[model samples]
Structures are given as C-alpha cells and as structure tokens.
Target chain A: MNTKTRDTLGKVGVFALASVPLLDGIWRVTSGTRLGGNPIETLEHLSGQWALYLLAITLALTPLRTLFGWRWQLKLRRMLGLFAAFYALVHVVCYVWLDLGFAWDEIGTELIGRPTITIGAVAALGLLVLALTSPRAAVRRLGKRWQPLHRSVYLIAVMAVVHVAWKGKDGGEDALVYALVLIALLLPRFAVLAKKRSSPQA
Target chain B: MMRKAISSNEITPESVFLKRRQVLQAAMALGAGSLVGCSVDSAEADTPSAATTRALTSTGSTDFAGGENWTPEKLVTSYNNFYELGLDKGDPAKNADWLKTDGWTVEVGGACAKPGTFAVEDLVNFNALEERVYRLRCVEAWSMVVPWLGVPLGDMLKRFEPTSNAKYVRFDTVLDPDNLKGQRSSILQWPYTEGLRIDEAMHPLSFMAVGLYGKTLPAQNGAPLRLVMPWKYGYKSIKSIVKIEFVEEQPDTSWNLSAPHEYGFYSNVNPSVSHPRWSQARERRIDGNVLSAKIDTQMFNGYADEVASLYTGMDLSKSF
Candidate 1:
C-alpha cells in the first residue's frame, strides 16, 4: 500500500485491536454470557487484565522495532499506552464505585492500609501522568525530560504485577503469568543498559 | 416398624434410584459442559453405597426469621467456596461429582468419654435433624442465607460427654486426593482443620449440617457432614468433617495458619475489623442482583444478639 493508505490501515488496525476487549466486555454484560456469577468482579478483572495486556503490548513496540526493523509498530505505541491508561482508570473506578460502593472512607482506608491497593494506586498515578503528557504539545514542552519521565512504565509494570500477586487469595498463580510477560518485555532494555554500562563512552 | 418408615421414605428400588441418579448426573454434566474439567468414567455405574443414610425427621424448632429474602437455591448451589474441590466458585459444583460420601466415618476423640470412630449414619441417626435458616458471611465480603437441615452441634457433641479439660474443639475435613483435588496442592497446609471454643461449639446456633432445602447435602456442599458456625465467617465452618478433637488449649486453624495476618483465629463477622487486603464493612449478597448496591454487613452477621455475649470480654480487633 502507498504511504497514505498504510497510515490509514495502520490506524484502523490499532483501533480494531484496542476496541476488542472493551467491546467484548460490553457484549458479555449485554448477553449475560462470560461475566460469571459475580458481574462486578468479572468486569473488574476483565478491565484490569486488558489494561495489563495493552501495557505489555505498548512495552513490546520498542523491542519489536529494534529486532525486526518494523518502524511502523512505533506509531501504535501512543494509542496502546493511552488505552492501557484508560482501562486502568476504568479498573480503579470500578473498584471504588462498583466494588467499594463509592465509600470514600473505605477507599481511603484501602489506599493507606493495603499494600496491594497502595502499589496499584501508585501504578495508576504513574499511568495517569504518562497519559496526561501523551499529547504532542505536552511532549514538546517537556523536551528531553519526557523520555525519562515516560520510562516509569517499567516501574508501573512491576507494581501492577506485585499488586495482583500480593492480593491473591491463594498463591500468586494468575499474577505469575503477567510477571513472566513483563520480565520478557524488560529483558531487551536490561541488555541495552548492560551494554551501555560496559562500553567506555567517556 | 423403623424398617417400614425407612422403606416407605426410600420407595424407589435400587435400580430405579441408580437410573435416576445417572440421568441427573448426565444432565448436570451436560449442563456444566467443559466447566466440569474432570471426567467421571461413563462406563462405570457408581452406586450411592449401601450405607447411604436417610435424613430422619426431627421435632426441632424452625423459628428463624433472621435470614429473610433467602438467596435462590441455584445461586447457593452453583456458587460454592469449597477450596477442597477448587478455587473457582463453580468448581465445586462441576468437579465434586466423583466424590463418594456413602462410606464415611468420623473419629471423635481427645477429652471425650466416647473416643472412637463412628459411622456417619450413626451420628446423624443419633441426633434429631432440625431445619435452621442461617446467614453465612464469607471473609471475601460476600453473603448467603441458606436453610440448612441438621441438628444443633451442641446436642450432638454433648452426647459423647466432653471432659472438663476440653477447652477447644478442632474439626478436620476429609483429605482424599481422589475427590478433593485441592488436597494435592499444599495450599494452606493439607488436611484443612478448623476450631471452635468449647462454649462456641455448644452454642445453640452452631449446627452440624447434613442437608440443604430438604435434600441430602450435595457432594460439593460438604456431603455427609460439615460444621456451620453462622455468626462467624464461612471458613470457620469446615466442610466434609472427618475428625473432631477436643483439646485443653486453643486449636490451630487452617486459614489462620495459612496467613496469620489476613485470617484470624476468631473469624467472626465483624464489620470494624478490616481484613489486611479488604474492608468487611459491607458485603455483596450473591442472590443474582450484581447490579444492585452492597448491603452494610451486620455485626456478627446479624447474629450479635445470640453470639455477641460470647466475645464480650475479648478485644476482637486485636485477637482478629
């Protein structure tokens, strides 16, 4: 396809891929199929899982571009990050409003008392910062600092995994799967860091 | 004369009963589809054992207005929290089909006058089976009101005549890996054990449940026998009890041992005592109304009137 056609197709592909989870959630709610017995918990889990999945996808873009020379994958990173942040926002809202019954007192108690909640809150806050500054104007204004500030995705990814694992009723079997994915995504970054440290650039 | 009563109640012939069970089993298996996970050998015709005891009628009181607007039986049965079967709510209903409870015995020992293993039937036959409606509050902030058919645990335990030294009562659940899949995993130390204070054990509200809604307890719902401490969290009420021991000191419990910080020894339904991970102030009623708001959890799950005095001197927040 031509440059204009490729751009249009790429945007279309991103939109369709991103909307799949949200649409599936809506369909489940409407059809009364896969939401399980507890709809609130089902919705919460679905949104949270999608958020993690999108975040992982966002992180994978850099590695994919470097390894395969697929420069086009970089264009979709912004959309994936925003979607991850959006779903994460949904996750937090669902916990506070649907699960907690908008009990601000209880939410406050959870934020302070529970490590899982505290870690999740911190991750959500980081995502919020990235999402807010994702616009072209904000990125341009931030200049060189934008790249460093946005790298907090690494920290957010770790916190997300820890939050789920720590709050698991049984052992962290479900969390372990996500943790493995995040580790794989971070491996390339670690290798690059190691190389930079080894080379005598000075 | 007793034979006539038994024969009259169990009118269907053994062949017919087996056929009906097969039909029901097939229907359940089909309805559940892939969710059941484990397969029961379709070729083998499993019998409900010769020792399958009937639920005897009792003159016990059914005057409980506490559990109003009862949760539907479907929700209650389908959504179980039996960790023995699996972690998922539906896992028990799906996976517990292979569980054979007919040939079961419970060993009651330690500080009791009668310290011997007894048939499960004999234990049920000995007690007057009463129907009691109780609200079960789970530590996960979910609640269910179930009409359980059984006897007062106090009445049943007292028959054995506990020694004065028996300060606590420890109950152990069945640990067969063939039925209890979770038993294979060391998820909270195998052979799940729960305990109650001697006084708590003898409380009028505490029950030894064998059935729900006029039917014998389903395999998933702790068939044969299970302890029902309605005022406390559901975990306190251990399922498929295999052993009961009366000891001088406080007995070690499963959940408390699993995570001391999360699950306390006295897992009473207290709204004030927040679980390290979640708040206990409110609970979602699992009655198919997921969209509706959560109800404020009552102190002692609305059994404070009956069980509150039991914990009067103790600081529940610290003990929890």
Candidate 2:
C-alpha cells in the first residue's frame, strides 16, 4: 500500500532470498561438495551466481515498486543494493581464495587475461565505490555527486550480464534468466530517465 | 550391424601379457581423463582373465602387444564423463547416490506388440563385464583408452519385439534437483533427455555398462547403470537412466534445446568435424599419473571400421 509497507516486504524478501544462496554456499561446503558442476569450476561459478543474483535483485526493486505503485518499495533499495554488494564480495572471496589460491599474481593474470573476469572486476570496483558512498555521511558530504556515483550500478548491471554471456562455457540459461529479469526490472526506469533528459524543464 | 572380428596387428602376443609388470611403470606420464578405468588394479584384478597396470617406465616398451595397454589409474579416471549424473568428471563419483536404480525399468512401448516396463536386472545380467579395449572421446575434445566390458544394446532391444513405428529411442535420467544441484541451476534441462535413431540404439558397439574396472558401477560414475557408445561423444550415452521411452518421432535432447548453435543430436565422434567453439581433433588423455602426453584422438575413438556405415553420406561437420 504505502512506501513503508512496500519497503518492509521488499526488505524481507531481499534478506530472505539473500540467505538462501548463503545457506546453499554453507551447505555445500559443510557437505564437502565443492561449488558448481566440476571441482575446478565450482567456487567461481557459485561466486558468480551470487554476484549476478545480487545485481539482479538490486535492479528489480524499483520496477517492482512502480509496477504496483508501492511506496515502501523505495525503502528497501538500500538493502537490496547492499545484498548485491554482499554477493559480489563473496564472489570476489571465492575467486581470490579457492580459485586463485589467494595468489595475487594469478588474480592479476585472470583480471588481465580474461575479458569476463576483467569486466567483472571493474563492476565490483564500481560497486565498492557505491558501497562506500552508501553510508549517510558520504551521501551527505557528496550531496549531488553521490547520486551519480550510485547510478554506476546501471553500468555494473550491463557489464555483469555481458561478462556471463561472453565467458560462459555454455549460453548459461542461469545467466540469461537473471539478465532478462534485471532488464524487466530496470527498463522502465531507463525510459523514465530518457524522457526526463530529453524533455525541456519548464 | 554386427562387426566382423578381424585379426589385426592390433592384438598383441601372449608373451607381452605375461611380462606386463616389467613394461608399464613409465606409463604415468599421461594426463587426467586419459583413461576411464579398466586397469590391472580397480578395473580388473589379478584374476586369471585380468590385466595388470604396469608403470610405463617400469618397462622399456612404449606399446602393448594386445589391445591398448591401459593402467588402473588411467582406467578409473579416464572413461565416461556423463553430465546427466552430475556436471564434473568427479561429480558422478561424488553425488550419484540419490539416483534410484533398484526399481528402475525401461519402457518397451514404442513399437512392441506387447509394450511394457521391464526391470533392470530382469533385462540383463550385471555380473559379467565384456572386456573390449576401446577409445573414449568427449565432445569437449578429450580422449582416453578404455577396456570396456558389457553386452550389446541391440541384444537387449531384441528381447522386446517391435511391430514397426519405432523410429527413435529416448533415454531419461533420474531428476532430483536437490541431489543434482547443477540441474537446479537450469544449465541444461532439470531432468536430462537424450535420444538416438532406433538403428543407432541397436548398433553392436553400443553397450549398456553397469561397471568399470571389474567392480560394480561406482556411485559417482553413474552407479547403477549407464550406456557406453564408443563411436559417439560422451554425451550421446545417457547415464543413471530411469526411463527409456521408445517413440515414433524424434525426441528433443536437453543440450540441443538449450543451445542449438552447439550440441546437435547426432553427436558422433569425428576428428574432422569441429564444434563451433572448440576443436575435436586433439584429446587430452587422463591416465592418472603423468597428466600429459596422453596422445592424439582418432576418428570414432578408433571404432570407425565397425561403425562408419552409420553415417555414410551425411556431412558430420554440419550435423555436429
């Protein structure tokens, strides 16, 4: 009904959804099953799925609010965005720890050698900036500048989708479905932004 | 078509079999997936009809006198990469317990005068393994030498008499997304589905294998049951099968539907035909020790003479 009510629901949904992947990660580890299909490919894919889910969930909040005109939807944006960041962080941890074996040199090699890994790293870097700016103090300090910094999530979303599309050994229906959902969630916002930019301010 | 057994320079002398211990120590140089287990150790023990896994360096001979001389380490790890069981080469070995084969049955419905489901044990005996060393290849461009033991699929199919109209045969694997976490991800379809032309299903070389390396099938490796089509890519042979539906029209396969640009239903092994993204010409062999120099892959996993007639006129590259 109201923005606050929508925000509460959105917050619950995001947190609960976030916990599923976390629980899955923990269960897999505890069960002694490595992530993904094969051993060599597991941790990275698990991390990637988390990162992809976070970005998608973050992108989804606004359209969800608009579609139903729920005011509370606005309140949960921060939580969803943070969850995206959380998954992205786990993705990074998996890549750094299990995949690269915490070898900085190997990390650098993956970042340089693979275009998907490179784009993913850049997206993570952008999210890092946004995460730091997410705090009230930085938002208050940057004022007008903070808004632009956060908008980078849009780029992060696009890059994240492309990274999976390009790097996936398969076409990755998992990646494709996430991309489609993210697009459905974000397209209306894009049209609104385009309209505002094009129309002359009265 | 039943293949004529031709005596080639292929079968080695009896003396080499007797002195295998001295010649195989240096063999560890091969890579993983080099062989899928039919070794002197796990695949076949020191029984009267068994072969020993001598280290390649233990003896100066780089070659074996009989069918390909593969080690146990190579045999256990080298053969069969069925994704329907799980995604990884090892996933089949790790998480295949959820697959129920005890009450498993195949649907003999398509063209049979009296179509019905037949229990697995009633259909074929699992105790005996028909050992034939063959080349195993993957669509991903890897190969291994395997001494396979099993019966012909056609032999089993013949038990169910067809009245006609059976153009295609489909195999369905057990689908519990909880156990098959990879299926839960929607990479391919949740329950994997694959098919073959009725003739292909009835080919002599197509064997439904229940075990490798002389023991019962391991849980991780499609366990209770799996198929072995030496002439086709690993995927063509379905694993952990629960249902075998015989149909009139062609069936939709999981990989072909998921990515049509890749994965054709006719996934025959041909070195000349390359996949859109990768080469099928060379293979990385996994013999469990050396991890390198496994050797180049041959056409049809070297079973072409027996199966070439299956695809006489069709362009393999385009079909692939």
Candidate 3:
C-alpha cells in the first residue's frame, strides 16, 4: 500500500483498537454479563488499565521508530496520545461520577489527601495538557517549547506507574511489568545521551 | 422463633436475581463442559465436598442486627478477597473450583488440652447450624451484609478444651499451592493465617460459618469452615481453615506481618482510625446499585454495642 493509504489504515486501526475497551464495557453493562459483583469498580479498573496501556503504547512508538528506521509510525503518535488522554478522562469520570457518586467533598479529599489519587490526578492533568497541545496549530505556535513540554510525558508516565503501584493490594507485579517496559523504552535514549556527553567533540 | 422484620430494601430485586442465576448457570455449564474429557472416576473424585446441601437453623439472636440490605447472593459469592484463590475480587469465584474441600479436617494443637485432628463434619455438627446476618467490612473500604449459617465459634473452641496458656487463637488456611494458584505467588505469606484474643474468639459474636444464604458455603466463600467475626475487618475472618492453634503469646497474623503499620492485630472496624493508604470512615456497600454513594462506615462495623468492651482500656488508634 502507498504511504497515505497505509497511514489512513493505521490511524483507523488505532482508533478501533483503542475503542474496544469502552465498547466492551458498554456491552457488558447492557448484556448483564459478569462485571463481577461490583460493576463500578470493574469499569473503573478497565478504563484505568486501558489508559495506562495506551499511554505505554504512545511512548513505545518513538522508541520503535528510532530503533527500526520507521518514519510513517511517527504520524500516529498524536492520535495515540489523544486516545490515552481520552481513556484517562473516562477513568477519572468513572471515579468521580460512578465510584464516588459525584461527592465533590470526598473527591476533593481524595485528590488532596490520598497519595495514589493525587499522583493519578497529576499524571492525568499532564496527559490533558499534552492532548490539548497536540494539535498542529498549537505545535506550530509553541515551536521549540513544544518538544520540552511534551517530554514531560516521561514524568507523567512514571507518576502513573507509581499511582498503580501504590493502589494495588497484591505485591505490585503489574506495576513492575509497566516499570520494566518504561525502563526498556528509556534505556536507548539514556545510551545516546551518555554517548553524546562522553564524546563532546563528535 | 420470632422472625426479625426485614426491610423492603434488604430483599434483592427479582430482575437482578434472575440475571445472576442465568450467569451462574452459564458458568456451571462451562465448568461441566471442561470436565467432559476427564475420566468418570476422576470427575467424581473432583466433586466438591460442600456439594451436598444441609438444612440450617437460625439462633434468632438480634444482638448483631444492623437491618442493612442483604448484598445480593451472587455478589456475596463472586466478589471475594480470598488471596489463596487469586488477587482479583472475581478470581476467587473463577479459580475456586480447583479447591478440594472433600474430607477437610482441622488440626487443633498448641495450648489446647485435647490436641487432635477433627473432621469438618464433626465441627459443623458440634452445634446446630444457626443463621446470622452480618455486615462484612473489608479494609479496602467496601461492605456487604451476608446471611451466614454456622455455630458460635466459642462453643466449638470449648470442645477442644483450651488451657490457661491459650491466650490467643490462630487459624490457618489450607496450603495446597497446586490447587490454590495464588499460593504459588509470594504476594503474601502462604497458608494465610489470622488470630484473635482468647476472649475475642470466645465472644458470642464470633462464629464459624459453614454456609451462607441457607446453602453450603461455596469454595470461594471458604467452604467447609471459615471464621466470621462481625466486629472486625473481613480479613480477620480467615477462610478455608485447616488448623486452629491456641497460643500463649499473641500469634502472628498474615496482614499484620505483611504491613504492620497498615493492618494491626485487632483490626476492629473503626471509622475514626484510617488505613495508611486510604480513609476508612466510609465504605461502599455492594448492593447492586452502581450509582449509590458510599455510606459512613460504623465503628466495629456497627457492632460496637456488642464488642466495645473487648477493647475497654486499649486505645483503638494505637492498637490499630
């Protein structure tokens, strides 16, 4: 397939894949399937998991292109990042509306008092900023500042992993897996940075 | 027996019950389908010990009454925190079929006069099975009202003849890593252990639950035998008990050993004292309502009237 056709198909594939969890959630609610006794908790978990997964996928794209000479994949980053932000939005909405039942006082208390919730909120805010600045017009307007701002995704990803680690009851095997993936993604960047610092003349 | 008035809200809606019934039927069909390839003898041998149903009698005690709506039976059975089966709430129900409850026995040892292994049947038949509705509050800030059928744990403990040295009672869950898959992971100390003070164990409120909702206990709910101390957080009520040890010193508990700062030995449900990770002042009741706001959690899960004396002088905050 040509570049335009491949990109179009890829974007559509990404959109469809990102939507599977949301659609599956709706289907489970409508079909009376096992959302396992606590449906709100289930939905909250599903949305949060997908949000983290999509964020990880978004981060992996740059590493994939750098490692494997793939230019076309770069165009899909914005879309994936936006999808990640969307899922994060859903996750927050589930917590506030469904889980907490719009109890703003309790929500405020959790956002400020609870470490996991506070970390999650900050990471989500970072994703929101990234999503807002993702547009071509915003990108053009920001110029050099955009690159540095977007790099905060790395920090947000770390905070998100911490949020997950702190919230889990079982020893954080799930968080460890995410942390490992993040480490792998960062290693190549660190290696290049280390090499540049060592050979300044080059 | 005088029947306690059950509020209308306490009853599960027919629609929800029917839907759950269908889901359970589907799950049972799938379970049977998987067993199709196994030899008849093997399948027969694999039959759950609690498969046979037994009648239960209600003691008609209103001491621990809360008049809260009963969490739907499906939710009670499916939503469990039994780590031996799995970590996820739903995992216990899904993985529990592997648990072999047949010929289960509890070895009574340590500070007790009669240290002997007794079959689960003997314990269940020790006293007439009585039904008690209890509010089960988890450390995770979730609550459920369940109708548990069993005898008062104190009566059964007395039969074992505890000596003066028996200051604490420690209960141990079954340790079959092959069947209880969660045991394979080091998420927690294996063969989950929990303990209570000698007086706490002898408290009339502490019960040995053999069944729930007027049926034999499902493996996920800790079939054969489990403790149901209504006043304490749910974890204190250990499940699938295989051993009961009366110790002179305070016994080490699984959660307390895992996180001393978080889970204390007492673990009585106190709204004032919060878990280090989250607030324990409020809890969401899993009553089939997805949109319901969390209700204020009660001290001792609303059994403060019956159990406040157990911690008369000790500061709950410090002990907790």
Candidate 4:
C-alpha cells in the first residue's frame, strides 16, 4: 500500500480501537447485556480503566520513539493523549451524574473531603490542560513552555495510580501493575537525562 | 407492624421464583416499580443446584423503621465483596460456584467450655430463623439493605458455652486456595479473619445468616453461614466462616492487619471519622437504579438506637 493509504488506515485503526470501550458502554446502557447488577459502577469502572490504559499507552509512545527512532509514532501521540482526556472526562461525568445523581452539594463535599476523589480530580484537571494546549497553534504560542507543561503528565500519571490504589479494597494489584508500567516507560528518559548531565562537554 | 411467619406452603417453586424475578426486573427497568413488597426467591438462576435452591422459613424480625426499600435480590447476590472469590464486586457470583458448602462444619474452640465441631445444618436449625432487614454499609462508601434469615449470633454462641476468658470472638473463612481463586493471589492474607468484642458478638443485633430472601444462602453471599453486624462496616461481618474462636485478647482482624491506619478492629459505621482514603459521610445505595443519589451514611448505620449504648464510654473515632 502507498504511504498515504497506509497512514490513513493506521489513523482509522487507532480511532476505532480507542472508541471500542465507549461504544461498548453505550451498548451496555441500551441493551443491558453484561452491564452487571450495578450499571453505574460497571460504566464508571469501564471508563476509568480505558482512560488509564490510553494514558499509559500515550506515555509509552515517547519511549518507543526514543528507543527505536520511530518518528511516525509521534504523529499519533496527540490524538492518543486527547482520547485519554476524553475518557477521563467521561469517567468524571459518570461519577457526578450517574453515581452521585448530580447532587451538587454531595459533589462538592466529595471533591474536597475524599482524598481519592481529590487526587483523581487534580489528575483530570491536568489532563484537561494538556488536552486544551495540544493544538498546533497553542504549541507554537507556548513554544519553550510547552515541553515543561506537557511533562506534567508524569505527575498526573502518579496521581492516577495513587487514586486507584487508595480506592481499591483488595490490595492494589491493578495499581501495582500500572505503576510498574509507568516506571518502565520513565526509566529510559531519566537514563538519557543522566548521561547528558554527566558528559564532559557540559 | 407484626410479621407473619413464612409457612412451608408459601415457598416459591423454582420456575415461578425465576419468572417473578424477571418480571420485577422488567418493572424496575420501566421505572414503574420500587423494590417494595418483593418476595424472596433463589438468586442463582445461572447455577441451578439443589443445595442453593432450597427455601427456608423466616419470620420477620425488627428492621429499620425508616422504610428504606430492600436492595433488589439480584444486586444483593450479584454485588458482593467476598475477597475469597475475587476482588471485583461481581466476581463472587461468577466464581463462587466452585465452593463446596454442603456438609460444611465450623470448629468452635478457644476459651469455650463445649468446644466442638458442629455441622452447618445443625448450627442454622439450632434456633428459629428470623429475617432482619439491615443496612449493610461497606467501607468503600457503598450501602445495601438486605433481608437476612438467621438466628442471633448470641443465641448460638451460648450453646458453645463461652467461658469467662472469652473477651472477644474471632471468625475465620475456609482456607482452600485450590478452590478459592483469590486465595492464590497474596492480595490479602489467606483465610480472611474478623473479630468483635464479646459484647459486640453477643449484641442482639449481631445475626448469623444462613439464608437470604427466603432461600438458602448462595455461595457468593457466604453460603453455609456468615455474620451480619448491622452497625459495623460490612467487612466486620466475615463470610464463609469455618472457625469461631473465643479469645481473651483482641484478636487480629484481616482488614486491620492489612491496613491498620484505615481499618480498626471495631469498624462501626461512623460518618464523623473519615477513612484515610475516602469519606465515610455519604454512601451510594445499591438500589436498582444506576442514577440513584447517594444517601448520607448514618451513625452506626442507623442501628444506633439498639447498639449505641454498647460503646457508651469509648471514643468511636479512635476505635474506628
């Protein structure tokens, strides 16, 4: 296949893969198949898991580009990051709308009083900022500031892990796996930074 | 309101019970019916077994006067936190069929005069079973109202003859790693254990449930026998109990051993004391609706009237 056709197909594939959970969630709501007894919790868990999975995949892209010199992978990073943000937004909406039934007073209390909720809200906010500034125009305007701002994804990822671990009932095995993945992705970048700093030329 | 004793004739046939559940579910979907006036039936339609399908006789006992609707039987059976089966709420119902509850035995020892092994059938039929609708508040900030049929725990403990040194009661789950999939993973210490002060154990409200919704308890809902302390967090009420030890000192509890800062021996449902991770102020009720608003968690899960005097001099926040 030609480069143009392959690229178009690749983008379509990414979009379709990312859209699966959301579409499944909709189908579950409509048809009530595999929604389990507690539909709200099912959807809440579904969206939150997809968001974390996408965020982890998005973070992994950078390390893959650095290690394999695959420049084409960078083209998908923004779209993947934005999809993560979209799911994160859906997760919060499920919490506020379906879980809490839009009780504004309870929502305020949960945001402020619950540690896990607070940490999750902050991570969602960080993702929101990253999503808003992901456009080409904003990238040019921010220039030097963009890299540092986007680097906050590391902090957001840590918060997400903490949020999940804290909320889990049985010891946080899921969170541990995510933590290990994040560490693996971050280790190569830190090694390169260390090498650059320790060089005699510097 | 006086409740009539459930007669053997009133027992729902398996087919009719399953059909009624489906109709109730449809009515709920149409938003035309609340869970009020719904009768008990076998919950496990997927796993049809003679043991789980058996019906039990239950006379209604004291329940919350607040008129909170019973959480649908499907949710009560499906949504569980039996770590022995799995971590997720739905895991228990799916995986608990592997558990062998027939001819189960519980060993009564440690500071008891008549320390002996008793079969589950003898233990459950030892005293008349009474159905008590209770508010089960989990530390995870979720709640459910369940109709549990069993005798008071104190009634059965008295038969074991707890000695003077029996200051506390420790309950342990069956430790079968080969059968219980969650036991293979070290997420929690094997054979989950829980304890209660002697007084707490003997409290009139502390129930030993053998059945729910007028049917024999499903394996997922802690079949054979389980404790139901309405005033404490749901974890305080251990499931699939195989051992009951009466000890002098406060025995080690699974949650407290796992996270001391978050879970204490006396995990009474107190809204004032927040868990290190989450707020205890409000809890999402597992009613049929996915969009139900969360309700304010009550002090002692609304059993304060009967159980508050038990903790009269102690600080609940510290103990929590």
Of the candidates numbered 1 and 4, which has the greater DockQ value? Answer: 4
Off by over 4 Å in 3: A199-202, B1-63
Going through the candidates in order, the fraction of native interface contacts each one reproduces equals: 0.29, 0.05, 0.43, 0.52
RMSD of each: 6.3, 13.5, 5.6, 5.8
Off by over 4 Å in 2: A1-202, B1-89, B176-183, B287-295
User: What TM-scores do the predictions have?
Assistant: 0.84, 0.54, 0.89, 0.88
Better of 1 and 2 by lDDT: 1
Each prediction's Cα lDDT score? 0.80, 0.63, 0.82, 0.82
Among these predicted structures, which one has the highest lDDT? 4
The residue-by-residue lDDT of candidate 1 on B1-320, one tens digit each, is 01112542258765677677779767655654444333332212232322343444554537453527666555666677787888767677666665677678999999989888988777876356787878888998888878788888998899889999999999998878876777776677868999999999999999998887556777767887999999899999899999999999999999999889989888999999988788788889875544768889999889898889999889999987
In candidate 4, what are the lDDT values of residues A33-119, reduced to their tens digit?
A: 456656787788889998999999999888887788887777789989999999999999998898877878878887887788999
lDDT of 3 by residue, A80-114 (tens): 89989999999999988988888888889888888
lDDT of 2 by residue, B18-136 (tens): 34632442252132113322111221111112231111111111111125645343245423355545444554433445455556676656666666777767666654346555556
Q: Give the per-residue Cα lDDT of candidate 3 at A119.
A: 95
DockQ of each: 0.23, 0.05, 0.39, 0.35
Which candidate, 1 or 2, has the higher DockQ?
Answer: 1
How far residue B183's Cα lies from its native spot in candidate 3, in Å, is 0.7
Which TM-score value belongs to model 1?
0.84
